[model samples]
Target: MTLVSGPTGGGSIDDFELFYARRALGRLRSRLGRQGLLDLLAEDIGKGEAFLRESAGLSGGSFNVGATVLATRGSTAGEFVAWMDKAFADENVLLAAQPEHYVMAGQPDGAVHIVENIGPHVCSFYLGSWSAEALAWAADAEELLPEAEFPHKKASNLFLADGTVVGRVLIQFGDTDDGFTSSLTVYLPTACPESVLEHHLRHFAVEFRNWIVASTTARA
Candidate 1:
């Protein structure tokens, strides 16, 4: 309810809004009771999922939203990814690293795709202009939609090479000299709430900056 549902310039996501959606949903579950909440979710799930394609434009608008975070100090992209991998490993979250898959029209085998630019100097929307990883990922763009599950919390998504939906993590990193200028983008399906995706993007930005600090300190 607190989300900037309409539109905003630069499309920056808010970390506070990210947490608010989850907390609000939790409160709704408490107030409505589990069954009540589940019933509502169940109803929306079928409708939202069924017409996901029809709502593609709307979802695309939602997906455009993003956030940026600066590292406390300069570092390599590998260091950033290392910290991210370990963070999720500790949480026991599923990961699909370097994910790829052929996208078929009209199938739940997979419905949508999202890209996370570790630190976005290059825009993913641009063809033949994105960073190396993005360009490499683009090589298969026509044959398949990169396999990825939108993460609910902070951490790079594990882009599934096998394109398996078994996991919901799609991690991508940008190879930046300073690492302080990294960025992330989430390509979400219409079935997923736009606001929630925005929330996740915010979480990803905040956590990434935090990891930068943690990793930097540990090495010092």
Candidate 2:
């Protein structure tokens, strides 16, 4: 795969998924405090398919990956949820949350049009919101279990421009004593390099952190 330079003013990970992911994890650990980070891991452990195992399950030219971030400290779940409501309704905010080479636009019918430039080829998908059951599943406290009053969750299934189902994404948030945590999962059929998945993970880290900070700041 051809590795293109990412956006200016951003550290681009062209082919260093492991290195970048480790660094991102360390940074998150430092920022969230070791105990706070441990809280995240405690929740993540033994949950559903292991990350690499899930990645290996990809077949027929498709793959999936996810990233989790301790988005904010000292904010209520309701506050974060309200912020997300406004943020998702704003196209600009949604666009700002994406990494380089990924563009998202909202449709009139509440679907999202996504264009991804994955180096070797461009892929387009229309993402429609998940049903209530799916949303609850995505917001489950455990990876593969459902939880009540999960605080917030937004999810969608990806479809080709022609309407063939291709993949899905889930963004879920939960409340903690420290604040809110976010888990972002992306599944796609692009069959891109593993580095691409890592890049998106880092993308989730940076963008969600900023948005969480913004949310708290606004409340303050």
- The top-ranked prediction according to lDDT is 2
Clashes of each: 20, 0
Candidate 1 accuracy as TM-score: 0.36
lDDT of 2 by residue, 1-220 (tens): 6457654544435536745754665455447653453354443432311332333345453546555655567897778778876776665566444433234567787777665433233455577854575455344434432345354667766666556655567776777777766767766544446666676666667667767777888778
- Report lDDT (CA) for all predictions: 0.38, 0.57
TM-score of 2: 0.59
The residue ranges of model 2 lying beyond 4 angstroms of the native Cα positions read: 1-63, 98-103, 116-122, 133-142, 145-151
lDDT of 2 at 97: 48
- Tens-place lDDT per residue, model 1, 1-220, is 3545655644346755655664665455447643453354554433433343334434443333344444434776566666654543331111112111011111132222322222211001111112234335324323222233211122222222232221123234444444434545555544455565566566565555556666677667
In model 1, the worst 10-residue window by lDDT is: 120-129
TM-score of each: 0.36, 0.59
Q: Which regions in candidate 1 have their CA more than 4 angstroms from the true location?
A: 1-72, 92-179
* Clash count, predicted structure 1: 20
